[model samples]
Target: MASLLLPIAAAFLLLRVILSATVIDDLRNLRPPPDFNSTIARNCHHNPSLRYCGNSRPLDEIFKFTIVASHLCNESRNPNCVESFDKIDLRGRPKIAPLYLSFDFFWKFCPLTIRSIDFSNNSLRGEFPTSVLACAQAEAIDFSHNELSGDFPVERLASMVNLTVLNLSYNHFSECKLSESLVFRRFNSSNFVHSGLIPNKQSFAVKAVFLMIGLPVMVILTVGFIAMMCFRRRNLSLETPQLRHHFTTSMLKAATSGFSSENLEEKSDGVDIYRGILRDGTHVRIEIYWSNISTEGMRKFIEECEVLVQLRHKNLVRVFGWCDDQELRAIVTKWTDRESLEMWLIERAPPLKHRLKVLAGVMEGMCYLHKSWPQVGYDLGTSSIILSENLEPLISRFEFDGRNSSAKSKFVYKHKFGVLLLEMITDRGKMGDVEAGKAGFIEHIRTSFTANWQNLLDERIMIASTTMEQARQAIEIGLACIDHSANEQLNMDWIRHILLRIYRASCHVNGSPTHGRFDGDRDKRHKHGP
Candidate 1:
């Protein structure tokens, strides 16, 4: 019984194969059903896996598709039919017979709607087929193991946007007509074996070199270069910086017009900051606390100033002197007339270059504070950055960081400075009222950073698209600073350097004047802060 069953199954399979071939030949010669629906229904009944018909079921007319081979059209039976293909896929099928008609007319009038074509190992003969060009939408084409000859369409193949795979191996083809190395960058040598053509492999070799050897070396060299640059700049910035100066109470009072309310610029909860100009034409910002304050509060302020005066960078406000008289208690420093950074960001809507310059200066100031005094930073927000006459930023506040001297405290300043950076680029981020907390504000900014960076920009300022990209780096640095975990390492100096590079690029692109340095004349030039 087993031997009889084996013979019966073999006979059935052979009969099915012969019937399939006969059906295909009949399909070509005989007229198809009156419409595609009957044809698909019949095909599904015979073989469910035919084309797109799945599970032996025919689809509705809406989902029905037409496959026009262009060469196998029944002109007599379908005279009014459109010479167009909707879909076709013949994978792992039998070798194709010769075409029925010319494809020139169809190519001119109809769109070739093929997704892919596989004619590999077809035992085809003659030159490369021009009809293949008609299938412009084909993503993959296989013409390997054929007797195809003549100049291959190397130049034309490069123009196909969707064509990805091309197999021409074991073919007697001519030399590659392309001189550009990029034309065959995607293809491999095996695809053109035995043909007088070579794929451009230098790109892959170069990329491999970069990944394995060149990349690590480049990274090391880059890190060393930045370290060297930062070391030089840091030493230059700290060139024999002396301690603070002390002035008499009489001179401060004279400068502030007897500390009257008229000279007062800003009044905080327990602080009255008076803006004054010296007789020598030097402007000054005088800090004095009173009203709803105890002696301890004043003492803390003095102590904070003592720490601030010990260290100095060009970005920090220049401490001219403090008036420690018999009764008066005040800390004085060289001030800016243009007021705080908050005022400028909110009111002026400064252009990209100015904003970048401010950001770089602030980053520099923060880097110095974190590096020089690990247990220090500020907490007063954007109001802490006072602007000099040349519109340069000068950090004016300091937090002794006695409350939290952990690693978080060191990064807290970085995070705060990041917030300032976000504010610099955008105006619609209702940071305080809508997005209340630090994390909330950062989330709001993140949502605003859509594909279009232009929408979030402060439109009051004019800048080019490239400048806008630089502005994007500022926001990224801000977000990175805020989101970085305690364990994550960051390079504050490198960040500062990146910001300065952005400012310089923006300046060059926007055709703005160079950002000024804190020269000796900066002391001579008076500034009154907000």
Candidate 2:
């Protein structure tokens, strides 16, 4: 019986050994759950400076916490770094104490998975890190209440479409000249509160100071000076009758060949524009207003004449004189052989460089007018811009009557300029259909800008990488100009500067200077006539 029991025990022990071996084999074959701690541990080894809570905690939670806390906290400064991790909030966890981290160090070590960064109320000084522009996925950034200095990267920040919130107030930053793009317009004056933010305010303050000191003194001096000058002028006017150059009805009729079909260039709103040559062989265009003369109409015409006579710019058509006869009222101006922008665009497809030069010229003129005479408004449109013999753009037929017209609003000018830009790039004649309704125009541009703006570009023009970049920037500027929000519209100064930059870049791409000093033969090839 003892021998049988011993054999049974041996069999049982052998089975147990076989079962244990099989279990070990199965365990070896089956892979263990992935240990995230390995990756954390490797990163720690790679970066010796990186600190971790411990290897005891769950790997997933500790890894996420370490990534955030590593750059945010310095163990030397605050030994209780692990305790602060619990207070982390999605909105933003304000620092209880300042972090003495350089911009480069923070950005280099900060994980790309971070969605929000709040570095407010710190001493983060240095030039804005260009690396911040790479955080494409970052949504919110608060750099307010810091000692940041140098030129803020407003344009680059604006380009980040994913960025929704940005607070840059209370910083030691230099004046940031924000372009009137959708990104810059997203913030208000509140975003930028430092001195020199609004350039005009400084001049305005100086003017105010000068006015307070000099106004009374000048008023007294002017009262005495004007009285004497008025008496002398009254006597001179009575004696001389002020001989002025005026065109008579018969003279204009003769010049325009009695308003013949060949001479008639355009007739709109009871105004007939006739192309004519003067008796002295000078080419001219005669604008004859045929509407029945009303008191208001005559007053406005006189006011426009006064304003035009005072204005002199290379980009403005030279107004020779006006005809105010009882029967016919006309304005005589120098003729632009190259004709209106609308006609030139239809007849000749200019290269991007030439088109940008023309646009720059227009903006320069507009900027001048907007700055020198804020009260004066222009009737800006495609037909209103005329090209000179040298392909220079001139703003013509812009009459100011000392009244606010919708066309005079900076927003309106931006909209018109945007349409003109779109025309130049897309080869579209007019944006009448798009501008007919504001909603449709916005949606069209927004969609096209996002999906594929290249499709909208003119196929006639060859698109290189540099040229494509320029076109994309111009399209963005156009979109910003025509933004539905009035506040979003770029001021004439900003628009002019941006357009000039684009013009310079375009000229560089074409191997020319900012003024586009092309060869005589190339110039001749591009010249067109009405």
Candidate 3:
């Protein structure tokens, strides 16, 4: 009996040693050495259950989960799931069964490849997740009708150029100042109805002053007194010529014949543009902002005034003055008889020589603006370019925001200038097509040039072999300007030199006088023109 027990004990001891060795081998295989090269891999290696590594699940399963989660509709009854990876539109969902999203819940589960997110009318709550801003490829984001609170990060939002359509309306957001970037400017008052988004500095200052004073009675009296003084001073100053540049409400009323329908040239975006003649017989364009103008619109009107006041260029439309009386708010600018560039391009395509001359004038004006005031930027487009009575091109409208001016602004200017050049060569009525896709305007031009350069050229104008080389060079310069790489984009000075060279070459090829003589004659004619 003792001998049998001893044999059994020995067998148990051997089995225990084998099991211990197997467990040790398994642990060694499971725990890999730290991979310092990749932080994610290293983290996953240290903790095998990390979610980034699918929490021990297969990578395919993780990807599938992300895709499925992103498409899951918020509808309580029958959630319609979509399979799209780029855009997610869940607009006008039932408010009673609102989709309540938490930052962790969405970020951890949703697909990261989404480019456009539309969560409008979701009845979502909580502050907007800044983590979502890190999605560099996100283009259009609509968060309207949500119960979102806190300050809207306008500056951060503006940094993303890909983010075009941003809707933040009907939210419980607090007062926040918007940056003068195109992103913020694209949104109107409707995008911020319940949200406390201040429109202008004046309103913000007034609010700040009132808050600081705190004494309602004293603040009211002081504000009233200041307003009275300003009204009196404005009336008194109107007698001077310099001050008289700003037409009175009565004078504008008389000029427009009590805002008659005949005076109305165009009506756009709730504003009426009227053709008015001053007492001196000088024609002017008056843009009257009626009460229907939203707070955002009024802010834009003020911004326009501010930008126009600083600009002083022959090629630019002259802002004579503005009227901001109790009953009327209007902007007055010098009127031109010739049609807009869009109209001219569509109705009557000019000759190549004439187009080159107009383009040269535009480049000169752009060069001046770029050099003299690097802080100011123009939104160059066909509609912004107006033809004068002498058929000279005038940059009638521009965008200027000194606060947000940067190296990127220069690139934007160059890109728009490239679009202008494309417009010239193609004789296209609009630049919309060029700016429509991710391939870029330069890519579109290259594709067209590769397919058939002749087809890309304006068919209305016959090209002579003598100036064909110059046209090709001009196109090359334009293509270079719109290069995807910022380092490749030509500087304003270089662009000017190339444009001037092209103009001179065109002039010489057309049997016109040499550079200096022809320019001098043209300048004289322009200066003395009707």
Q: Say which candidate scores most in lDDT.
A: 3
Which ten-residue region of model 2 has the weakest summed lDDT?
521-530
TM-score of 2: 0.47
Summarize candidate 2's per-residue lDDT along 1-530 as a digit string, tens digits: 01222233234435545767542223212222255445556656666544342345444444333333432443223355432322212222233323223233334334455566555665566765566565566777667766677776666775677787767777666655445334556666566556234344767799998899889889989999999898977787455432233778898988989889999998888888899999999899898888778878887776666566566888888877788778978888888777788787667766776777788788878767766765676755778888986778998867564544244466666677877777677744233466545456556667777877876677655543347877888878777767666424446656666666776778788786536432221322211110
Cα lDDT computed for each candidate against the true fold: 0.62, 0.63, 0.64
- Name the candidate, 1 or 2, with the larger TM-score value: 2
Writing each residue's lDDT as its tens digit, candidate 1 over 1-530 gives: 01222233334435544767653333333322235455455656777644445533333311211222322222213353234334333322334332321334333223455555555665667777766666677776776766777777666775678877777777777666457435767866566676545643776699998999999999999999999988976776365332325567788789989988899988887778999998889888898754444668666665666666776787788776665555666778777776788887777767777777777777777767767776566653777788876676888876664735356665666667777887777765534466566567677777767665556666665433445677777777777776666213556666666677677677768665554552222223222211
Q: Candidate 3's C-alpha lDDT?
A: 0.64
How many times do residue backbones clash in model 3?
0
lDDT rank, highest first? 3, 2, 1
Better of 1 and 3 by lDDT: 3
Clashing pairs in 1: 335-527, 336-528
Whole-structure CA lDDT of model 1: 0.62
The sequence of per-residue lDDT tens digits that candidate 3 reaches over residues 396-420 is 7655566243557667777777778
Regions of model 1 farther than 4 Å from truth: 1-251, 277-281, 291-302, 323-328, 403-406, 429-438, 448-454, 461-466, 511-530
